[model samples]
Target: MIQRDHIHMLIQINPRQSVAKVVNLLKGGSSRVIRTEYPEIEEFLWGDSFWGDGYFVESIGNKNETVMRQYIR
Candidate 1:
């Protein structure tokens, strides 16, 4: 899941899942894990919504860096 300048994980979440729910779960879980492993990232992790409202999901093909960057934006 590690790239030179980034990382890409092929997670297979439910297709019908709500983006908000998924984002919230991920954000909360990730922050907790980061805090548990190392506390320094906590300050850098706190935000209103780290993920955008909408998502660009690619189920059939590989997503390019530009596309992934836009998705994370």
Candidate 2:
């Protein structure tokens, strides 16, 4: 879901991948696309970074998938 200043995504990834790596890939890839496609965004950004320095992550394990998905939605 997309909001004014943030987005909620329910992503399922391979178990071997670290959350940090996934987050980095998502942020870096999207940042490049947004910057390249819409250079005007630079004016609203701080320095050279597009995303914030920190991210929030939660592990739902085996039982709370439905709850998490509902929360994100």
Candidate 3:
């Protein structure tokens, strides 16, 4: 929730799930909800997709939890 341009999140998914799968689910679900709830956003989207196709994914690995939380902030 960093305005309409981007999102900063620190989500923990199951080890069996792929990052791309989670991303697609989140984006797709959010897009559908936004479109249904907010008709005005359609003008800004200009296309069928509410979000851009591109996304950034990173592995938390052994990074410190506090450090990651602060970074997202």
Candidate 4:
């Protein structure tokens, strides 16, 4: 939500779900929306994929909130 290629977000998921599932949902859903909304960008995307195949995720415990917030900022 912060930039075109990167996002700064905080989300809470169910304990049963894995982080990879969340990443896939976000990337897959956004890719569809982006391609549908902006047809012109199709040519610039890599092999019909808008987002890259990899992502970075970090879990911040309550004790590490300050450290994570400062790092992200």
Q: Quote each prediction's TM-score.
A: 0.46, 0.82, 0.88, 0.76
lDDT agreement with native, every candidate: 0.58, 0.88, 0.87, 0.79
lDDT tens string, model 4, 14-39? 87999999989988998899888999
For each predicted model, how many residue pairs clash, with residues at least 3 apart or on different chains?
A: 0, 0, 0, 0
Q: Which numbered prediction scores highest in TM-score against the true structure?
A: 3
The segments of candidate 3 whose C-alpha lies over 4 angstroms from its true place after superposition are: none
Stronger candidate by lDDT (1 vs 2): 2
Q: With candidate 1 superimposed using the best TM-score fit, by how many Å does residue 69's alpha carbon deviate from the native?
A: 18
Better of 3 and 4 by TM-score: 3
Pairs of residues clashing in candidate 1: none
> What does candidate 3's lDDT look like per residue over 19-72, in tens digits?
899999999998889888998988876678888889998888999988999988
Ranking by lDDT: 2, 3, 4, 1
Candidate 3 — worst ten consecutive residues by lDDT sum? 1-10
Give model 1's TM-score versus the native structure: 0.46
lDDT of 1: 0.58
Pairwise lDDT winner, candidates 1 and 4: 4
Scored by Cα lDDT, where does model 4 land?
A: 0.79
Is candidate 2 or 3 superior in TM-score? 3
Deviation in angstroms for 73 in model 3? 1.4
